[model samples]
Target: MTTTLECRGVTAGYLKERPCVRDVDLTLAAGEITCLLGPNGAGKTTLLETLAGLLPHTGGAIEVEGAPVRSGRPRDAVRAGMVLVPDDRALFRQLSTKQNLLLAVPERSRRSSALKQVLQYFPALEKRLSVDAGRLSGGEQQMLAIGRAILQRPSVLLIDELSMGLAPVIVTEILEVLRRLATAEGTSVLLVEQHVHLALGSADRAAVLVHGRIADRDSAAALRADPGRVERAYLGTDAA
Candidate 1:
């Protein structure tokens, strides 16, 4: 498989001395979805932010298709074909849905076709094009957030807490969209999720992070067969 995104020995956090994530190594292949699972405050978001260049890493390097991504330089990440959909769906609250999606496509000539493509993945959004993003339901807002990212044509997509505050049915629907994106667009996805079962179900692989370190990693099928092992890792009773 071709490597789309990779990080080696990354360490990052709010404070210099106490890194929230330390010595982390991760890789994503084209058209693959890897679920990053960990307990709350285990630095899942920190790791994703570091990888996306939203936060500077104190150590190690991130690369997209062999091009280095400079720390704390979001443009570098974006230029390298990496995009992050934060836990908070950062949509322009007052902007119409169409406007929000249009902002991601800088070329006016492509906006119409790009939006039409997005609507194919999320047909529901077509009806809400005139509606303000803030007025959409949680699920619709998430769809908009991801729709905006898709418009950017990201090769590597990092999503933080995609299932947060959403219903199970909605999460399932979104996961299906992600699968389609991976299959059709060949986008590499790194998903940070708290819902272990759902994440494992949709991902090709799973990595368990415990207290800022990777406790275990394996094929999602293997993890699903041995849920006790994953449970132990989350409980801090297992490492590696």
Candidate 2:
């Protein structure tokens, strides 16, 4: 199988502290949704950050399409076809949705209808394009954030917290959009999700992260039936 993203021995953390991610190894295949599950502070977000080059690795390597990428150089990572759609979306709050897309790809002219392609996958965002980015609801903002991430047709898409603080209905909608992207665009995805059940619902497989290391990996359906396996990996002991 051709892996789009691979990490081996990635160790990273805040300054003067134990590494939040230590000796981590993972692979995301093309056209796959690989969910990441862990308890809070298990370094889920930290791993994502490290892989995106937002955080420097104290040890190990990150490779995209088999070429090594240096750590702590986020812009280079983006240029290498890896896109991280952070929980915060990083949209221009003052800008309209269309304007945000405009900035996503400066070289591509006449992308005015870019929102249409986004809407085909996330209909909820279609109706919110003209409005200021800050006014959209949490789910809508996530959709917009994800839409903008895909504007450049990244080879790998990293998402942190797909269902955070959103209504159940909204999460379902976003999952559908993610599904379409994975299927239609052949984008490799890595997700750090708190809502285990929801993430597993749409993913093909998931890696359980515990205190900055991979503890278990299984198919999404199998993980769904017993996510407590993941629960135990991150929560210190076996779950009841």
The per-model lDDT (C-alpha) reads: 0.93, 0.84
The CA lDDT at 9 in model 2 is 85
Query: 1-240 in candidate 1: lDDT tens per residue?
Result: 999988899899989899999898988899999999999999999998888888999998888999888999988899999999999988999999999999999998998899999999999999999999999999999999999999999999989999889999999999999999999989999999998999999999889998898888998889988889899999989544
Clashing pairs in 1: none
What tens-digit string does per-residue lDDT give for candidate 2 at 112-207? 666567777777777787999999888888888888998878899999988878999988877777778888888899988888888888899898
| Candidate 1: stretches off by over 4 Å | none
Report the Cα lDDT for candidate 2. 0.84
Residue 124 of model 1 has an lDDT of 91
Model 1 quality (TM-score): 0.98
Worst 10 residues of 2 by lDDT: 107-116
Off by over 4 Å in 2: 108-110, 238-240
Residue 132 in model 2: lDDT: 95
